[model samples]
Target chain A: EAGVTQFPSHSVIEKGQTVTLRCDPISGHDNLYWYRRVMGKEIKFLLHFVKESKQDESGMPNNRFLAERTGGTYSTLKVQPAELEDSGVYFCASSLTGRHSYEQYFGPGTRLTVT
Target chain B: AQSVTQPDIHITVSEGASLELRCNYSYGATPYLFWYVQSPGQGLQLLLKYFSGDTLVQGIKGFEAEFKRSQSSFNLRKPSVHWSDAAEYFCAVGLAYSGGGADGLTFGKGTHLIIQP
Candidate 1:
């Protein structure tokens, strides 16, 4: 099985610009999650998707950030009016359904630099 | 709320030396614990996890972690350090919510291990 894959390994955008990061999870995995890490900070969860429906979005930092998983497949995270503080690595992960497993397969991550 | 703390920011260990990385968590109830390793420019990889039963857990790469309820700690250990072990290690706590799915993990700042050859 293929591991999670992300697009545009690195991205650079000016402040106030919109940026979108994509993630293609492993086939047949029903759980998808998004996390980000800022400079000198721990990786923090942004949201989770069980198929096309969002299961949990409590960790989302703000309304400017939006995530969608259409047709229960790939996911996209959009950041509008990006700020300098938004520069960090965004990771996507997937896992099998039913089990509360900690073994989440992660992608290479997209490094976003907002200037 | 659940939270994890890794007191050590960085650690340097010579090849063949023993290694230990400390992790502490704060939660009202018992929380699932995990250790993840991340190589340079890579995403986090699961090293091991502790849910119940045995307090000691073994993981890949000859890694192991001991969960101590008394200390509220779950520390990762390796008998011998390898050059490839040089990377960032993160400790996380999984919170169980009343809702269906569990809550996202709460991670520590991470400990960067430097293995000297």
Candidate 2:
């Protein structure tokens, strides 16, 4: 089975511009997740989707960030009016189940650089 | 608040040597502990997890971890280190879901391992 794949391995945009990162999860996976790691910071969760429904989005840092999963097949994270602090690596992950014990497969991650 | 701490920022070990990466977590209840590895420019890969039962848990890529409730620690260990094992390792604590669900994890800053030839 193919693993999770992300688009635009690296993205560079000016501050205040908008950027969207896409993720295609493994086939038949029900759970999709988003996480990010800022420079010199730990990787932190952003949001989760369970079959097109936002299972949990508490990890979202601000209102400018939005994530959507359509048809539960793919997920997109859009950041509008991106700020300089938003520069970091964004990761997408998926799991067969939303249970606590299952392992989550991750993508290569999209490096976003907002200047 | 739940948090994870990886004491060593980086470690250097020789091939065929035993390796240990220390991890400490602070949570109110028993948490799901995990060990993940990430190569350069790659995503985090799950190595092992400890939910319940035996404290020792085996993972892919010849890795294992031991969970100590008393010390509030879950440490990753490998019997023999290989050159390919050089990567960034992170220790995370899964947030307990009240309704039998899963929540986002709290991860440590990560430790970079260097292999000595």
Error of 2 at B11 (Å): 0.6
Tens digits of per-residue lDDT, candidate 1, A17-38, equal 9999999999998789999999
Choose the strongest candidate by DockQ: 2
- Number of the predicted model whose lDDT against the real structure is largest: 2
Give model 2's docking category: medium
> What are the runs in model 2 whose C-alpha is more than 4 Å off?
A98-101, B96-99
Q: State the iRMSD of every prediction, in order shown.
A: 1.9, 2.1
- Per-model TM values vs. the true structure: 0.96, 0.96
Worst 10 residues of 2 chain A by lDDT: A95-104
Query: What lDDT tens digits, residue by residue, belong to model 2 across residues B27-101?
Result: 889888999999998888999998799999999989999999999999999999999999999999876455455
Candidate 1 per-residue lDDT, tens place, B8-63, comes to 99999999999999999998787889999999978789999998999999999999
Two-chain complex of model 1, DockQ on C-alpha atoms against the true structure: 0.62
